[model samples]
Target: MLHLRVISPVSRTEDVLAMLRVQPGATHIVLTRGGALDPEGDAVQADLARECADEVVDALEAMGLAHTGAITLEPLDTVISDAATRARRLAPGDPDDTVVWEELIGRTREESTLNATFLAFLTIACLLAAIGIVTDSPVTIVGAMVVGPEFGPLAALAVAIVRRQGRLARRSLLALVVGFPIAMAVTAVGALAAQAAGWLSLERIDEIHQVEFIYEVGPFSLVVALLAGSAGMLALVSSKSAALVGVFISVTTVPAAGFAVVAATVGQWHVAFLSACQLGVNMVGIVVAGVLVLVLHPHRRRAFRGTQGARPDRVW
Candidate 1:
């Protein structure tokens, strides 16, 4: 379920109420007339099924609420009312399959932006993976995957291509273009430091099963990347982000980069080259999978067409 908070201009208040009253998925409509001081309008609160959110938001946008007023959607942790249950039952489709596009664009726009914190997390994640590579610990490698911030920008790139947002495309590309090299360089320095401290050695890289997956490019890697990318995108659009943790560990993106750094730092040039190839393969596979998923979904196809058809003044 989703909570909608709307501000409607004085003249549009009746229109807003009429719209909500007819929506089967909306319940518990509350209105406070002449209550808003900022824009001098009415305040409205309603509960609606998550599957129905996009339609309601689209209607509101069409009515120009976005220009004169505001509309906000928030996830409800709990909705115990019978009205809420009925709303969910009356909703047209499965909530998880619905594309809440406004919410999605807002999310990826924030995540794709290049920032210091993103850089720091990316570098730290690769460093953790470098340690995991040196020690041959699957547990530590998974930990590094959990910390990695690369998925956000990668996902952003997929979304940008599908939506035809040139600015977003550039921003997402910038994040990846700049982020990976910086992360790899820092991990290389960390590898050298670990060797100097006697905490790592080149010998472990040859024997570790986990290291082989990082340093070898294989058919199975592409299959895993496809599955992980699809699952990761599902997690994003469905708001079931817990699924993304598995996606993170399943694809050896950061781990491969980290392994490459460690191998090159220790002068294992052949292993480094293979690891780099593995990293490239995973990156391309994930992006392709994500794009395929978005393109394949019927709802997203309609949404994409709408996005492409909209005038430049209209933003989703």
Candidate 2:
């Protein structure tokens, strides 16, 4: 659920309240008469949601009756009667018409279980891909695609940008910038070691046929990435973990990164560069598409706002 705190001039409190009352999927509403502030205006607190938030807010602004002095939204666990259920409700279902920022990043900061697991999985996926590329194994390459953790950061970064959360965006970008290169480097080193051991050879690693599937970076890849990114965002907004997994599988970030590592290992600089370009292109495409989806999708914002108690209104 979303918790909104609003501060406006005293004269506009009722106007704001009236707007809040009509929002759909708003589970609760709380009001504060006046609060301490500098010279701005009186403070009013609202605990509504995304469903009716934009409409109500837009209406208030259009009416010119309410002037927003300050606004804040905090996510809530539940409006449950029991404290245990409240505490145990980890994954809150998003409001029908709101946007949910938490799903993109996972709830909580600094070492949430999902984040930690994603990192670990990413490492494993990259390692496997490196092995696959060195050995020219299609099976291993596909496996790496299934394992990579790049999708989470990519999705989160898009949501952050759409929601205007600079911190979230920075964190997600940091994960990607640091994560991708590290995965590539590790994969390259692994491939080199495999070559020295005679488990694989530079010629085998550089074979065009092995990773050629991704070499054809054309409109198909762009369209697929766009669609996959849209699916990823929808999964995030809808709390569909299984569909998110499918999204990760559909995108080619891990496979391309792995192919690049294999090429770099043998000093096939040209192919390696091409593969890297492919990876970069796919990454940028998916992320940009995801940001657009989040910006255009209301559920994500409303989920962030927690409008369970508010009245429902049409978003489209």
Candidate 3:
């Protein structure tokens, strides 16, 4: 369920209330006249079932509330009211399967930001992966996968393509284009430093076998990437965040980057090239699969069409 808060202009308050009153998925509607100071309007609040959120938001956007007033939706962790239950039962689809596109777009936009924290996490994950590769530690490599932040931009890229948002697409692409090389270069420098400190050497590369899969590009690498991408996207739209950890560990993107940089640092050009190939395969597979998932989602398609009448300048 979602809690909707809307500030409607004085003249439109009745219209907003009428709209909410007819929605079977909305309950516990409350109106406070002259409650909004900033917008100087009436405050309207209601609880909405997850399945009806897109519809309600679309209607609100169509009414120009987003520009003239305000509309905000927040997830409801616990709603014990029978009214809420009835609202959910009356909604069109199951909550778990519904896609709140506004929520999704907001989330992916934030994730795609190219910031210091993103770089720090990616570099640390790559460094951990490099350590795992040198010591032949599968456990450490899995840990590195869980730490990698590369999936954010990848997911953002997929969402941008499906939603046809040029600004979002550019932001996602910029993050990817700038992030990976910087992370790999930093990891290479770290590997060089370790080598200088006598903690790592080219000979260790020959002993690595357990983690050779990081650099061994094959058909299954792409297969795993595609599957993980789909699952990751499902988790995102469905709010099943617990499933994301499994998605993170299922792909070898971070490990491949780590292995490639480490191999290059040691002058193992062939190994580096293969690892780079593995990285490319994983990234392409994830983006393609994610785009397919978003485009094929029935609810998302309808929601996209419904919002076409909204102002082009509005950020969903």
Candidate 4:
């Protein structure tokens, strides 16, 4: 179920109430006159089954409530009312299949932001990747993959492409572009320092038992990337966030970036080139797979591509 809070202009309160009254899936309707101070409007609240939220929100958006007022959706973790159960049965769709584009837009937009924490995680992941490559440790490489934050923006980009969200696509791309370069550059310098400190050796670059897959770009790499990327998108849309850890470990995104830096530091020009190619291959595989999966999503009721002017959506 979803709980919605809406602030509507005083003049439009009746129109908003009328819409809510007509939605069979909506329950627990409450209204407070002049409840919003900044907007100085009436606040309306309702609970609806997850399957019904998207349509309700789309209708509200069409009514311009999201423009002159505000609409916020929060998941109802617990709903004890018999009315809630009845609403769910009447929603005419599978709750699990519902996309809830509003939620997705907000979530992907937030995740794609190139914040300090995002940069820090990316940098640390690359550093960890460098360690894994030099020591040929599978454990460290997996650790770095799990620590990498690139998946969020990458997923956002995939969603944006399928949904045709230009701003989101651009932001996600910018985050990955800026974040990876900084991280790879730092990893290169760190590799140099580690060599100077006698903690790493160039001789270990090609004499590794593990971590070879990080730079061994091949057809299998694309297969794993495609599978991992699809699973990651499914995890995101279905609220199965725990699956993300496994998806991270399965893909060679951060490890590939780190390997490129470390390979360059060791003066293995061919290895560095291969690592870079590996990164590109994985990205293409993930993006292509993600777009394909999302295109088939049941909840994508509307095709949003090239709709930059359809509605005013917040990029942030």
Best by lDDT: 3
Q: How far out, in Å, is residue 310 in model 2?
A: 19
Candidate 1, which segments miss by more than 4 Å at Cα?
Answer: 196-204, 207-210, 308-316
Better structure of 2 and 4 per lDDT: 4
At residue 117, give the lDDT of candidate 3: 94
- Per-residue C-alpha lDDT of model 2 across residues 1-316, encoded as one tens digit per residue: 5566667677777776766664443434566566737435556555544344454454544544333475555656555544323322422344543454432345412322235566677778988877766666778877888778777677766765665556667777777777777667767777778878887666675464765775557778878888988887676665556887778767778887777777766777787787777788778888888888876874545544533322232110
RMSD of 1: 2.3
lDDT of 4 by residue, 104-153 (tens): 77888898899899999999999999988888889999999999998889
Candidate 3, pairs of clashing residues: none
Residue 284 in candidate 3 has what lDDT? 95
How would you encode candidate 3's per-residue C-alpha lDDT over 167-206 as one tens digit per residue?
7888989988999899999998989999999878889898
Give me the displacement of residue 30 in model 3, in angstroms: 0.9
Which window of 10 residues has the lowest lDDT sum in candidate 1?
307-316
What local lDDT does model 2 show for residue 79?
53
In order, candidate lDDTs are 0.85, 0.63, 0.91, 0.85
TM per model?
0.91, 0.64, 0.97, 0.95
Judged by whole-model lDDT over C-alpha atoms, candidate 3 comes out at 0.91
Which residue runs does candidate 4 get wrong by more than 4 Å? 303-309, 312-316
Question: By TM-score, highest first, what's the ranking?
Answer: 3, 4, 1, 2
